[model samples]
Target: MAKIEFAWELGAHTGHVTTMLPVAAALKARGHEVRFLLREPHAAADLEGAAEIPREGAPIWSGPTINANPLNLGEILLNFGYHEAGPVKALIDAWREQLRASQAVIANVAPAAHLAARTLGIPSFEVSQGFHVPPPAMPAAPLRDWEPAPRARLEAADRRVLNSINQALAAFRGNPLTTIGDLFAGRSMLLTYPELDVYPERGPSDYYGITKSAEGKLVPDWPVGDGPRVFVYLYHYYKGLASLADALARQRCSTLALCRGVDSDIKGRHHGGSVYFAEEPMSVSRVLPQADIVICHASHQMTAQALLAGKPLLLLPTQLEQFLITRRVVRYGAGLGIAPEVNNPDYTSALTALAEGSEYASKAREFSDRYARHERGAALATMIARIEAALG
Candidate 1:
């Protein structure tokens, strides 16, 4: 059995860790040794045979969100140690130590690890839900294609980030990372639906299509209520969560909220005959079908799941990444978007519009029907087959 290494260095959500678990398990079951070098290793503590190693990622950037007026996916790397060579060089050495001894690499949103794997001549696999990167051939396409940046400005930003990456490689006695595409050498299965792609200009490839939503933290326990069924996925980080929960309680709806990373007391204050909470990382797979509408920060995975279930959405985005996804959902007529900057959003009106309106539900069902042929089981089997073949 060969050794397989999985890394999730950047990105905020625990979905990164959870997405890697199935692949790790499949490999382990086949007798290949699996190790996950994760930003949040505890996320995979339950995966029996796989070892979860932490602190091997590139230095975290606690800087302002927009390190530059990012034109494309590559320019955004400036916020993640690509602004300076020292940080990248140091991380390259550290990750090289961890990776050089491994047989293969599977990465998601970890550019430094990507560089390390490339430098070591290790064949790597990339997994993403679109927007994590630009296409392999065209590395400088606009991420926010709705507000396209000038070609000159885009070129300048690409030059700056590439210089930083290459200088770091040179300082570490490694070959220069020539193009932005080098960061994603695996040519990702590019897992996402065509409509959901935030960078539409980059266009399509052998799109792996969307996978099934991972199971929720707890099994569905629907509350008893006479009102509409509304599913909510809210993390603890959003400041307006408690007030929003209160609003959902006030509304005539049977709500099942996934209070991800939330405290029990928060649920205690909100949970009642009509409102219930799951205080863990819950997937929308099981609950989406039972809901008339869904509420979330427009995370791509959750948003996609909602549409797949023909459930309309009330999108509350908290960042540019989410805002883009929210915009796509809104454009598709399947959902509505609220700006992330809003402090006291009108949750009542948003819910009313989604619940009372027929158009949103119609569009959501249209999207679901249009993509009915895309099977998650088949997509997953394809991914497994590719990984196994690469290892062979």
Candidate 2:
């Protein structure tokens, strides 16, 4: 049996952890030794106590960014410790130790993990939504077409990011990547639908469509009420939670909310109303069918699920990645993107707009129809098949 390691170097949230779990489990089932290396070990809630989060971790860059408004994937990596060699080396070295210790025969990795594996000449493939695997051939295509940055600005950002990567390469006695995109160029297993892709410039690939969240197994059990069925999948402590929850109750929408860490007071305030709070993670598979409109941070999995179910969306983006995904959803007219930072954001209005329109629902169905024949768990099955083939 071969020892294989799956690694995630960046990003916050259970989404990354949850998305990779099933694939890891599948490999383990096949009698291959499998392990996970996550940026945030604690996010591995309870994976049947089999999930191991290494104490020696991947470098998570939270310091001041050289490029605050990243134009593309290359620039985005710049913000996350790619602007300087010291940080990049530190990040890569951290991943090196973990990969080395695992004695990894093969690797399925997110960004930094792959870089570390490359330095050690470890063969690997990427498993993610398309954003991280930037196209080296087309280096400067903007992430959002409507919000294009100046070419000079992009080049400058790329230079810094690439220089750092090259410097780190030098330290590892590796060849330098010619362009910023080359830093992330490699074999990728994209896990999103076509329309919801973060990188429009990335064109097309063999997508491994999405699977259900590994965090929760329970199907939704919404409270009975007489209004638009809205599914809330945002974080409990999000700034807009109070207003959004209150608005859902005030609007009398039959809401099934899964605010993972929601407090008692908020639940209390909405008590006796139509809002039902799921203290645990609820299956997106179950929630999507029952939802008239999906409200979330526009994470790829939820967005894909809502679209696949032909349901409209009211997006509340909390970060760059979520915002990027939200932009794609809105661009397709499948949803509306509302930043969580908006002053007392109008959740009620967004909900009403999505609920009141057939246009958004229609756009969502276009996505659903496109992949109407997609077999459930086919992506997971295909991924395993590829790995097994490669093993042989």
Candidate 3:
């Protein structure tokens, strides 16, 4: 059996680590030796059996924290800048060592990892949980060469971010400067949202069929009740859903709110007759199957699992991309999307429709049936096989 080393360069919460760990386990089941290189303070403890290779020891370098929060625009921009300098160089240094030992490397869509893998002449694959399409073809309005200087300034700032990323990549690989679009063009393998839930109109890629395993075993004794229950996933960074637990409680629906790393000051305010606050990662698969409806941001994993459970969703998406993903759900007749800034809008009306609407429930059931027909472990098995073949 081939010895395969997999690096989960960043692991903040359970979701970020989901893509690699399942594939690693499947490889082990297939009689291959698999090692996991992870960052410290992992959120998921189940990964203990896999050899823990620290970021400092791994051949590919990674930042101390993983940036997965979609709403932190300022943090995103700052991270883009920070990665351009220190982490990118460190990764190049690490990749040089990895090339002497390993046959290939795989990374998430982080540009620094891509650059390092390229520099070492190692085949790298990009795995993710979102769509990676080119920006939609929209009509470009002519920029006034003189007026509207603010718009031009914004454009220049955007270009600088892209330039910073490109320069770092080119510096390490000794290649001419290329646009961010060019760097992503046809270089890395793309594993994104599984095709079963995503629209079929989108073009196929090398790794589009990968599906995440259900987390049912995590919470075998999930709570159930007589009344209609709603499960809400609240991220500390996204404040749009701050009042959601209370709202569900006020409606007299049984509720469980999973708060991920929220501050102590903000906890337990939503307590009422029917609502409950759960700080731990509750088994979403168990909660989702019995949920009358789900309220969340456009977290693809949670949203996808809810759909697979035949539960209609009400998405309070906080970003442009999330809004777009929610739109896909609406287009597919599976869920509803609420703009984060629109607080006065009637979320109750949407939730009411989701819980009682026959059309919405039918669509959700259809999606669940379709997803169930596929072989459950095919995607993870395929990824392990590909990595083993690459090692060979």
What's the TM-score of every candidate structure?
0.88, 0.90, 0.72
TM-score leader: 2
Model 3 per-residue lDDT tens digits across residues 55-145: 3334434345334542222224334433455555565565555544655555543444556656766665555653432321111111222
lDDT of model number 1 = 0.74
- Model 3 clash tally, residue pairs: 0
Ranking 1 against 2 by TM-score, winner: 2
Q: In candidate 2, what residue range of length 10 has the lowest lDDT sum?
A: 47-56
Q: TM-score for model 1? A: 0.88
- Per-residue lDDT of 160-227 in model 1, one digit per residue for the tens? 77887888777656776556766665547677777888767656467786664445445567788676
| lDDT over C-alpha atoms for residue 376 of model 1 | 79
Give the poorly placed runs of model 1, Cα more than 4 Å off: 44-71, 136-139, 145-150, 171-178, 261-266, 281-283
Model 3 lDDT, residue 79, Cα: 44
lDDT tens per residue, model 2, 150-266? 788777777777788888889889888777556545456778877877777667667778864565655656776777999888887788788888888878888988887688999
Candidate 2 stretches with Cα past 4 Å from truth are 47-56, 59-62, 101-109, 144-148
Q: 2 or 3: which has the higher TM-score?
A: 2
